[model samples]
Each structure stands twice: as structure tokens, then as C-alpha cells.
Target chain A: MKNIKVLGSGCANCKATFARIEKVARAKGVAVTLEKVEDFAQIAAYGVMSTPGVVIDGKVVHAGGIPEQQQIESWL
Target chain B: MFEQFAHFLVYQLGGLSPASQLGTALHFWVMDTTKILVMLVVVIYFMGLFRTWLSPEKVRRVIQGRSKTLARILAVTLGAMTPFCSCSSVPLFIGFVEAGIPLGITFSFLIASPMINEVAVVLLIGLIGWQLTVLYITAGLTVAYVGGIAMERFHPEKWVEAYVWQIQMGEIAQPAIDTSLRGRHVFAVSQVTEIVGRIWLWVLIGISAGALFHGYVPQTWVAGLSERENWLAVPMAVMLGIPLYSNAVGVIPLAEAMLAKGVALGTTLALMMSIAAISLPELLILRKVMRVPGLLLFVAVLMVAITLVGWLFNLLN
Candidate 1:
């Protein structure tokens, strides 16, 4: 199981990123607890200044934008 | 090569007279769209890489407990680099307060983060000349810095919500990252793609307005408004801009349009900055943390500063 967190301020891109993660997790049959960290403090804690950041198990694997499914799956 | 291609593509296809409004509009549209889009990609890529090197923790440490003078400047610079949106405003505001960053310093950061936009920079450079671009940047930074300093001097800390001062968070530790050449390059590429992709439509809309203004507006009409009597245009533009909401990218073309239709550069920029700095939505969001008086003060300070910049620029020109 992986704890995957998506960071954004509910902007369009942020919402899309959240949707994409849910879809990808379901397709892979990955046992994951997905969380959306909308709080800027928590998001800034990961040192990801831009939106739609991805964090897996407390480690930020992506920031500033969305990543490919393959890359996201790899992180998971 | 690019210029010739744009000319051939726009002018050759229509087979219309270059002097005609339609032909001129098409030509302006193509030329501006291409230049702005190319600049947006390249500048965003580089800015993303530059952003990766900066962290909120680093910014916190720089200004934490510093004197008002130093913190004001640092806050403006950091705010310019960080792409902060309204959604993140609450948390960032709380975090800054918790970190013992001064109220005024935080205000500077908040003001600059929205006011100094990279998209605005690229579009300004592409549509207008670099001279005005530099002027806008300098004026923006100065306004942010001075407004913050004034806020600090006035000591409006009492107006902040009580809960803000009460929330306690432990020291934020510095984040460790694997700084490799490849990592930065990838980050930069992703940033360019995401930012450019999202804003391409707004850019198109902006250039379209500019195209119409360029093709149809008369020079004498514009010149008439440029005279000193039209100084009222600055305040009028600011007044009109505050109620509307749009990002810097969406407003650039409108600024160009206004400029084309007989508005002064300073007045046009004042309108754009007001849209960013004193936006109603942004103010409403900040109201969550600040009482009405503080919010009013913030808006007043910005209004005065931006107006001053507009008038100064008008005078200098």
C-alpha cells in the first residue's frame, strides 16, 4: 500500500491531477490511500512551490505540474 | 526566418491589402501570437528551473526576525519567484504568521506573488518593448516593498484574526533534495508544458484584442488621450480593474488593446496591476484572516502606490 498525496489549491489543473491519480490507482489495482493536501503549509513543507504536486509515502516525487501515468505508477 | 514566415503566412494567405483593417488585424494576430507563445515556453522553462532552487523554508529563514527594511525587500523578491494562487493564500498566510514573519513582510510577499507574474513579463516583452517591461517590474517591486513597509510602520497587527497568532507550529526543517542536472532539466520541461498548455487560450484571446486595436484604432485618437489632461485615466483604469478578476496572462492583451485604443501606457499598466493586486476575489479571500480595517488598509496602500507609479511613468514619458 502507498500513501499518495496530491497538492493543489483546487485549480483546474489540480482537480485534473486528483482525478488522474484516482483513475491510475484504480487501473493498477494499487492499494493506496490517496489524500489531497490543499493546505499551502503542508504543500510548502514538501518544497513544491507550484501546484499539482505528487507525494508518495511522504516523499515528493513530482511538483509544479502533472506527470505521466507511467512515471506516477513507478512512484507508487 | 520567423518574421518572414509570419508575414508570408498571414499576408500571403488572405491576399488582402496590408493597409486594410482586416489584413492588418490578421498580420498583427499572427506576429504577436507566435512571438508571445515562443517567449512563454522559453521563459517559463527557465523560470521553473530557477524556482526549483528556491524553497519556502529558504525564504522564511531569510526574513525571519530580520529588520523591516531588509525583510520588505526579501519578501518582494521571494514573492515574485513563488507562483502563489488564492487557494494557497490561507495556508501560506498562516504559515508566515506562525514562522514569526512580520505582518508587513507577509503583506509584501502576498502582494508581489500575485502582482509580479512571469506570464505578464513574457507578454509585455513580446507585445510592448522591453523598456516598459522593465519599468513595470521596477514599479511593481517598489510598490510592494513600500506598501509593506508602510503597513509595518502603521502596525496593523491588531487587525489580524486572533486565531492566526495563536496557532503554533514547530520549526519547519529545511527540505533535502537530490540536486542533479538531469532532475532540474526535467522539472523545467514539465513546468513549461503545464504553464504554457494552460495559458495558451488566454494568450490567444489577448492577442486577438490587440490585433483588432492595432488594425482599426486611429493614431490621433490614441494621441489625444496621451496628453497630460488624460492623467485621470490612471485612476479611472484602476477603478474599473478592481471589480474584475483575471490572471496576468488574461489581462496583457486587454492592456495592449487599451493602449492601442488611446490609453496611456502608465494608465494601462495601472489597470493591469490593479487587476492583480487589488482584485476583489483576492481581497475576499484575505478577509478570512484579516479584519475589514486591515483589508481596507491593504487595498488603500496599493491603490495609492500603483496610481503614483502610473502618474510618474506618464510624466516621464
Candidate 2:
């Protein structure tokens, strides 16, 4: 199972990012523990300034926008 | 030329009469949209390439221990250069503060990030002209500089939410970004796609509104507001703009329309700045990180500064 975190401040983009990650993971049948990090402190701690930053297993894989499906597939 | 193309499409091909209001409005919309979109793609791609070298983390690192004056200058300049989304403002704020960057300098970055950017500059040039675009950029940077200084005098540090100071930032490894030539090209292309995708609707709305205003609104209707004696127009424009949440891209075309209807340059510029800079939604987002007093102070400083800029330009013009 992969531990994935979506960091954002509850903006529309953040919500969309969270949804997309879930959808992609389910489709790929990848076992993942997904969490949404809304706290600014935690987000800043990760050094991700842009919202909807994606962190996979303690590694920030993307920031600033929704990740493309191919990128998500590669991660899975 | 875009004008000739628009003329041909609207009149020659579409078979609309040149003198018709629909024809004129359609022509204006088509010409302006085509020109603005083309300029946006080229400019945003270049800006995206430039931005690979400058990120918020990098900006924080550079400004962390600098002298006050130098830091403020750098903050404003980098703020304009950094392609930041308003959604990220809270984290950006906390990140800067956590890094020991002064509150004033952080405010400078916050002010400039939204108010002056490649999209705003490109749209201003496409809609109005380079002269006003230059003035707008100058005025934006000046406001950011002075506003930072002004906010510092109030000891804004005291007004921040206590929770912000309590949270400890961890040492997370920076993700290695692809910086190869092809990687830069891919980044630039994505930027163009994302930005154009996000703003195309707003652009169309703004241009269509301008087109309608151009086709129907009489010059005499706006003459009273544009008249030299009506000094209230500048301040009023600023106040009216605060609630009308829009980015700079969405406001410039409407500004061009107002200018065409004989509105004073100062009034139009003031409205554009206010709409682009001091938005209610952005303020609400900031409020989560700041106390009411701090939020009020930020808004007050921006309102006063923008109003002053409006008046100054009005007086000069």
C-alpha cells in the first residue's frame, strides 16, 4: 500500500485534486492510504507552497496543480 | 492584422452590415480575443520558462536575512516574477514568516504577487496600450513597496494569529524538479494550457461585456463620472471594485471599455487595481492566518494606497 497525501487549504482545486487521486487509485486497483492535509503548517513543512501538492509515501511528487493521469499511473 | 481579420469575418464572410451594432460588437470581440489569447500564450510560456529558476522556497531563502530596504525591493520584484496562485497565499505567508522573513517584506510579496504579473501585463498591453501598461506596473510596484513600509509601522507581527507561530516547520527534502531543456519546454506548454484553460471564460466574459458597452453605451452616460470636477469617481471606483472579485485578466477588457466611454484614466486604473488586488475572497483566505485587526489593517492600507494612486493619476492626466 502506498501512503499518499494531498496538501491544500480546501480550495476548489484542492478538492478536485483529492478526487482525481482517489479515482485514479481505484481504477488502477492500487492499495493506498490517502489523506488530505489542510493545515498550512504541515503544508509549509513539506515545502509545498502551491495548493493541491501531492505527496506519495513521504515524497512530494507534484505541486501547483492537478497531476496528469499518466503521472498518477507512473506513481502507482 | 487582427482588426482586418475581424473585419473580414464579421462583415465580408458573416455578411453582417458594417454599421450594425451586432456586427460592430462581434468584430470587437473577435479581434480583441484573438490578439489577447495569442499574446497570452507566447508571454506565459516564456514566463513559465523563467519561473523554473524561481520558486517560493527559493524566494524565501533569498529574502530571509537581507537588509530591510533591499529585502523589500527584492520581495516586490520577485513577487511580480513568481507565478503564484492566491490559493497558496496562506502557506506562502506562514512559510515566509517561519523562515524569519519580516512581516512587512512578506506583505510586499503578497501584494505584488497578485497585482503585477505576466498575465496582467500582457492583457494590459493588448487591451489598453503600453503607456498605461507601464504606468500600471509602476503604480503596482510602488504600492507594494509603500504598503509594506506602512504595514510595518503598525507592528503587524502582534496581530497575527497565535497558532501560526506555534506550528513548527519540518525539514522536508525538496523534490528534484526536471530542469532540462525539454523539461522547460514541457513546463511552459503546461503553463500555457493551464492558464488559458482557467481564464478563457473570464476573458470571453470581459470582452463580451466590453463589446456590448461599446455597441450600446452612450458617451454622455459616463461623462458625468469622467468629468474633472467629479473627484469622487476615483475613490468610488476603488470601493466598487473590492467586492467584484476578479483577476487582472478579467478586468482589463472592461477597463478598456470604460476608457472608451470617456472615463478618466485614473478612475479606470484605480478600478482595475482594486479588482485585481484587493479581493474579498482572497482576504477571507488571509483571515484564516491573521486576526481581524491584521486583516483590517491590510485591507485599509491597500484601499488607501490604491485610492491615492487613482487620484494622483487623475490629477496628472
Candidate 3:
């Protein structure tokens, strides 16, 4: 199982990224656990200043803006 | 229209005396708030559209492998145009370093990124006037350009930690931006609501302070300070502002309040720039990439540059 976390303050980009992750996971039939981290302190703890960060297994794979769907699929 | 609306609200419906404290405060609040919010929406929206066309990644691609002189120019201009924040500092720094951009050019971008941007200029125009706005932009760019060149000439790379050069990051592809008019509308509206929501309290606080100054503080007092023209004011303001962290927008109200209270224009501008560009948190974050000496040197260079600009403006005014 893959632990995937989407980090943001619930901005439009964050919501879009969250939706994209779910859609990509469902399409790929991957059993991934997902979570949204909304707290700024927690986001800072991850050493990410920008929002809409995608962390896979504790590694910040992407930070700032929405990642491409193809790139999300690759990360999945 | 803005003045009329404020007049109508207070004088017509509320029937408050313009001579009264409440009346004056409400009038100031209504007029300033409307002007700022209106500008915020129009400017932020168009800026969003502009941002969609010129992403930071694209900026990185263009600056990469360019000559030092050209890189310095692009870095200053693009850094001002690009929408970036302190949170992106580490990654942005790393990205530039990895792209083979020289330390000097990278320093220019880093210095300019937080200092000069559309939001600050728009707010300055709304609150102050066009003359100061132009001065702010030109001074800010000059600081970044000169500071970058100075740092580059000095060669402070030795103070960088060994690990900063070793960290590697692969570029993640960006999603396509919605460039349609409708898309820009949505983006702009969202930006307005988000920014307005976050800063409304500060805006109110600022207006309240301004109102207080307007009603209670004697004009003679401010003029008195100007007449005395304390030499330490500019340097003190720069020092006080550096440790405080804030964005260009968040600091507008306070800047307006200070100016309303008769602070020197150069001193007020210096305070805002320091708050926007330098902060303890930002310095701590940069700690990962630079040693204490390099960090101190960076601070010293910026402080000197900012102080000079402030003094020059004060002299001219």
C-alpha cells in the first residue's frame, strides 16, 4: 500500500490535486492511502514553503501548483 | 465614485458628523477599503493571466546557459514578474544552482523575487500616488542588480554548505494552465477572495490606526518630526523591519498607517521592502544552503543598499 499525502491550505489548486490523485489511483487500481494536510506548521515541517505538495512515502515529490496528471500517474 | 460612496454611506444613511471621530473613521475606512479591494481584484486577475503565460519553469529554461550580463537582466525582470513566496525559496535556490546559473545571477533573482512585484506597486498607487510607485520599482530593481553584482564579485560561494551542491531534484512536469477568459476570471476571483479574506483584518487594523492618527495626532507633530529629520530613523526602521516577516500585500496597511502618521516616504518604503524581502524565518531557511558568515554578509549588503535608497529618497523629498 502506498501512503500518499496532499499538502495545502485547501486552496483551489490543493482541491484539484486531491481530486486528481483519487482519480489516478482509481484508474490504476492502486490501493493507496491518501490524506490532506491543511495545517501550515505541518506543511512547514515537511520543508515545503509552497502549497499543493504531494508527498509519497514521506518524500516530497512535488511542491507548488498542480502536478500534471501524467506525472501524478508516474508517481502512482 | 469611491469618495461619493463613502460620503453617501456616512453622511446620508448613517447621518454621522464628519467632524465626529466615528464619522471620520468610517469615511476613511469605506474610501480606502473600496479603492484597495477594487484595485486588488483587477490587478490580481490580470496578473494571474500574465502568470499563466510565463511560468517560473519557463523562466528557468530561458535564463539557463545564458551569459552573466543577460542573466542578470532577465533574473531581475523575471523575478519581479514571477509569483513566488518564501516557501519556494529552497527549491528555487536549488533549481537555479542546478541549472548552472552563476551565484551572482541567482542572487539577483533571489533578491528581486520577494522585493518588487505587482501587488506592492498596485497598492502603493492606490494608497500613495504614481510617483512613489515608480520610484519604488526602480529602486527595488537597482538594489537587486547592484547587490547581485557585488555579491558575485565578492564570491561568497565558499561559505555555502557542502551539502547544498549535493542535493539533487528532478523536475516535475506542470499541469496545463487554463488560459481561457473564463479560466482567468475564475482564477482572479479566487485570488481576490483568498487575498482579501486573509488580509481584511490587517486592512481594518491599518485603517483604524490611520483614523486614529488622522483624528488625534496633530499635523504639527508629524511636521515636527520631519523638521527634526532624525538621521537614525531610516536605519532604525530598516533594522526593525528585517526581522518581521510579511508579504507586499500584508504590509500595505501598516505602511499606509506609518505614512499617514508623517513618517518620511523613504523610511516608510524602506520598512516595507525589508519586511517583504528579509525576515528571520527566511534567513533560517537559507541556513540550509549558507553558513553564518555568508548569511551575515548577505544581510549586511542588503541593509546597506536599502539604507542608501531610503536616504536618497529622503534627501530628494
The top-ranked prediction according to TM-score is 2
Give the DockQ (2 decimals) of all models: 0.27, 0.56, 0.15
> Interface RMSD of candidate 3?
6.5
Q: Report the Cα lDDT for residue B143, model 1.
A: 88
- The C-alpha stretches of model 1 lying farther than 4 A from their native spots are A1-9, A35-71, B10-23, B171-178, B224-228
The fraction of reference interface contacts (C-alpha pairs within 8 A across chains A and B) present in each candidate is 0.12, 0.48, 0.03
Q: Give candidate 1's whole-model lDDT.
A: 0.79
Q: How close is every model to the real structure, measured as TM-score?
A: 0.86, 0.91, 0.82
Return the candidate ranking by TM-score, descending.
2, 1, 3
**CAPRI grade, predicted model 1:** acceptable
Give candidates' CA RMSD values in order. 3.2, 2.4, 5.1
RMSD of 1: 3.2
Clashing pairs in 3: A49-B87
Candidate 1 C-alpha lDDT tens digits along B1-317: 55776679877866767777887788778888888888888888888788668766567778888877788888999898777777657656776787788888898998898888788899888887899899888988988998888788778898988876766645443433336977788777878888888888888887887777778778888787655458788888788888878877777878777777666778888998999888887787677778999988888888888899899988887
lDDT for residue B217 in candidate 1, whole number 0-100: 77
lDDT of each: 0.79, 0.86, 0.78
Writing each residue's lDDT as its tens digit, candidate 2 over B123-155 gives: 788777899999999999998999999999999
A1-76: candidate 2 lDDT, tens digit per residue: 8999999988888898899889999999989999999877788778777677899888888887677777788899
Which segments of candidate 2 are over 4 A away from where they belong?
B15-25, B172-176, B215-225
Model 2: CAPRI class: medium
Q: In model 2, what lDDT does residue B317 have?
A: 90
For candidate 2, the iRMS in Å is 2.5
What's each prediction's clash count? 0, 0, 1
